[model samples]
Target: MSSSWYRDDTAPPPPLAGEGWGEGVSTSDNPQEERTLSRIASDDAMRPPPQAGEVKTARGQMSRVLRAPLLLALALAATPAHAFIAYVSNEKSNTVSVIDTDSWTVTKTIKVGQRPRGIEFTRDGKFVMVAVGDDDTIQVIDVKTQAVMDSLPSGPDPELFAQDAAGKTLYVANENDNTVTVIDLEKRARLGDIQVGVEPEGMTISPDGKTLINTSETTNMAHFIDTTSRQIVANVLVDARPRFAEFKHDSSELWVSSEIGGTVSVIDPRKHEVIGKVTFEIPGLRKEAIQPVGIGMTRDDKTAFVALGPANRIAVVDVATRKVTKYLLVGQRVWHMAFTPDEKYLLTTNGVSNDVSVIDVAAQKVIKTIQVGELPWGITIAP
Candidate 1:
């Protein structure tokens, strides 16, 4: 196990859980209250914006050419600052690399706790959260400032987590203890914990925020926990070593990726059963190389992208038919992926090759390969 795609292979797995995404801590009591959007944001949000109707008047039109530059100057002066960013967690390096998506370069390197894997941004897009399993905490980073500001309490070996739609609570999957840790985002308090299968790893909340799903790696099952009751309502058996979970925009189906199963399991959210399975086959590639781990789908649910661990390729699946339509070759051991808010591009973390592959969503092809930190495990993009 000297070079396994997953960590914790030296010893017997502590049980399974899915805590993907990256970042390291915020301790401020008012963390949420301090979030600010990127510029194009006004110098002062309270200031009134220029009315477009005023520009339609005859007198306004006469002066429009002269006022155009002045208006642009004012707007530029009012710009506070923000950018589309991608956060990548390097397991071996124990740090998070912040990439400016526009520039496609590493802008900052953040020192985090040991074993930072799963990461995501808050609902408000103000802060990025990274699960530090060794520290038993989730660190928060300020988006505008690009600094580690605070942290929230997490369960043992917190590898993956999910937050409510309202951004009120966070549900964490604790790998070592076979439980899901719950935290109040506002209060930064430990709300509770939910018992799940052995070695629970994958975690994701539904689109409507009614159901929270956690997949246990060893149990080979996805456990659906109701957000309100904090109890497991249904358990659907999946393929082996389920590592990640994603839901479609309409919340009709939940996609679960089994790293060792070589297939993507589609579960019906309402009935809580395996409705379909997506399998991939590369002509010259062996079956074991096509182990699926991360999943990303278009907003319209027309296409789905699954990251094949050792295959060095991403399988594009037709969402409607659950069929493999294409395979785009990428860097070695591609793991997690995230799309730009506009859905123009998708970024995948190539772990073994120590870089990231940028794919053009419209063309369904990799456009660029960016050099990142060592063993870039999980990645997420911020608006």
Candidate 2:
């Protein structure tokens, strides 16, 4: 709502009110309960799908006009145009907000493990896995029913994670420990841990899935681990407090965002050398305030968007020229962003304002802001 909600970039986040997982929050083991939950999605098929360009205020009354079940079922069977579900992890609220892109509204808030962050859909799209840092594990949610069904053993304080190209292996960045935990996705077992630098926060794998990249906040280095050996092959030093790392689609460049350094290091993936840097400049904001945390690139690699944490802006960078083309004013403390499958729109999580900003990618304009849970950290859209 106001600028006062934004927290200081340099300071630690506000202390969480609750510590352990909430009561009755563990995975359900009852077969009946599981079956009942699965039927929820099926029963929802009787309701009519929201039409495109429909106003949000009128969405609630659509259920009242539901006609014959056959007609509604037919509507549900026919997929809506470019419909996708976006999941946002609210770090402080211990919940995941599910937004139906068709209506651009939050359809459900699913209760999850404590401090849920770093969420993504599995390759098969059957389930959504979210790293619950406080629980010392990753929780899995069934996509159809939107319920927490199981959990994976992650190391202590798993803040971020990256899956292999096949989605068979998962590499988790455990913030509390100086190691990345490797897990077998199919078997749902912990393979082992690869020691990295201190306070590892960013996790990403290359396009070929051979190299795993992890950035340590305290160590100020990007550790390149050979996925085959599960060992650190090389470490490239970056600026202060590197928070996030992203690779171009063609695997030519790797961009690492340094939070305190206020710059992004563009590294050559093949040579593992810093070839260039993407810097951001805001007219009235101090350098410290323009901390870059999350980065998103286009499929063609022609453009990139960097989230300026406290500056409350998204810097649009021209990839070839390496220049800031525009700065978009979004909600306060924009943390991360994800694009829809079609790339027609981009949604950003604004922590302080407790909402997600929808940006029309082609127009480069802020179109709408949808309210979500508190301290929204990360987001992932369905493929």
Candidate 3:
């Protein structure tokens, strides 16, 4: 096994129970209360004015009435605005952990084919598709029932995949065959295959849905393909063992993570060139342990978050400067990450620790750790 794979190949412990399902912790005992008083005009049409002796009692009742709605508004604001479901793929245990974002707990453990990885929610949010490499197929999980319902025809040993903006077409990187298989999502049938480099691992599509990218680990290159012809248009060499690729929302830049090189390559999509690189450094840790595998960027393209595989930290990066702003310590062997629909919280899967770390985006702080399945590899949150 390659030195990088050795770290992930070690026997993982049994899947841990999803615990710590407690109420949201409050930082302060009392929240800031706001009082909004309604105009109380004296009107003979409704009722006569209060007597002088009862004025004080009437004022007290009015105070209580105004405070009630303010308190109710505060309670509603403190609750989570949205409840998003997150699916985590467990590589070793052959299962998926379904987490409810509102409660911050795993509601279900879904048993699936062997070696599940590269999970994503469909555009319609009705189903979740997961690549089970060992089983040589992609399985579909029904969102409502929380069960495996069907399978897709993927190339041999499908690893990572990407779908078009419309979610009608799927491109899967088949590691064993050195090819990318195209599947018709609506029909649930295989369309064709596009040849790529050896051991293709990472997959992504552009925002306009005109181009597709597949990164090869063994070949150490990113192959850009045109969606119209399903042919490679350009090849750009990157650092060693590129494992994941991500594109900006505007399609201006592409980011590829090299696991063994311990760096993230920033590429210009228009020029198809490496424009910059984002590196990570943690005190007292060797460079070899800081292997970056997954990346997540904000919708506005201002900030980015990268998962350093064995370093047990998530590097926060400034997109404009291409510099690491801070490294937040997390669980062991962090693999992948996903953001909630509103981008308030970012969840990361930790393989060795068998848990996921929840980060409050605006605060840049690790807020919660949720225990999940064994060797959690990939994660996807509902839109």
Candidate 4:
């Protein structure tokens, strides 16, 4: 595909007319479908589980994939208070594109530091934080102006970061320094740094605000840090190349995706132990290509989505049983993802394909693909 295919614009060229990139047109909405969705939402299991102690559940999950997108509009209507604007970091393009979910279009693009990767919106939704690895600093973007307002003093080669519940403290993973840099978000100054295993890449804080977690890529372990003391209280070793760590909303489990290991290590947050490991299998793809990177789970924690990087698919895992449910084919080299505020939609960054794939949360299908900058990576939505 030509470089022109990746652009920050209102829309890409006509789908059929364009060269090779593919995107789905929005499906027509039916007003009467609201009642039907309500009944589906109320069901104990919208689709029946295969059987008790079933080792494989792909057949049942594949059947539900097509019908999931149809239910999201109704889910959004049920809770109308939360609407979000999504921001995506473009590593090669050195820019961040603002996406308007209502229209599913790129509304604006702001220039930023080179090699921008990890990005997130502040707790108050007033700002966006982007880690520019090459620049060795994290830039702050004002949500109202959509421009770079300031930069935080992150340690060398800062790749990812996590903030506290009150949004007052920031824990940054400095890949080059082998340490997690702590900063005071309010003061915009460095507080201190905690030395950790080499190549620290992922950072996430617990939902209850009691713990902060960092995953070192080379160490293959998730280091649990106590928020108050800023110490590595426990280290739970996981698969190789643990790139991203996420805490379940309920605080019961922490999921880490290992790109090279081709598995997701499911850890019990309370015990700092690996309870189970989730693996993926795609019929035609080689085992080496099944590199899992990003993860997203529903508020109920019933459904978990893992992005299989080079496999070009997202594996749906059953939360209760810790088994692979199904794999939904997406664009190339899928990297990171974020859910709409209402949890009705999930948008994932496809790096090699140079676009963002949208998944309808309820239907569990890739409903749409939006054109973004080259190597679209990190994504976060306003609260």
lDDT of 4 by residue, 1-383 (tens): 22221122455565354322223332234333444544555563565665787766677566566555557565566654434799999999999999988778999999999899999887777789999999999998888889997888999999999988777888999999899999888777899999999999988999999898999999998999998999989999999999998888899999999999999999999988999999888888899999999999889988889989989998889988989888888999999999997889999999999899999988988999899898999999988
Quote the positional error of residue 233 for candidate 4 in Å.
1.2
Worst 10 residues of 2 by lDDT: 1-10
TM-score of 1: 0.79
State TM-scores per candidate. 0.79, 0.80, 0.82, 0.79
Residue 244 error, candidate 1, Å: 1.2
lDDT of each: 0.84, 0.88, 0.89, 0.86
Give the lDDT of residue 311 in candidate 4.
Answer: 92
Model 1 residue runs over 4 Å out of place are 1-83
Q: What's the distance in Å from true for residue 154, model 2?
A: 0.7
| Leading candidate by lDDT | 3
Residue by residue across 34-100, what tens digits does model 3's lDDT show? 1111112212136566687875577777885686666557665775556899999999999999999
Lowest lDDT block of 10, candidate 4: 1-10
Q: What lDDT is reached at residue 2 by model 4?
A: 24
Please provide, for model 2 over 109-156, each residue's C-alpha lDDT reduced to its tens digit, 9 standing for 90 to 100: 999999998998887677789999999999988888899978889899
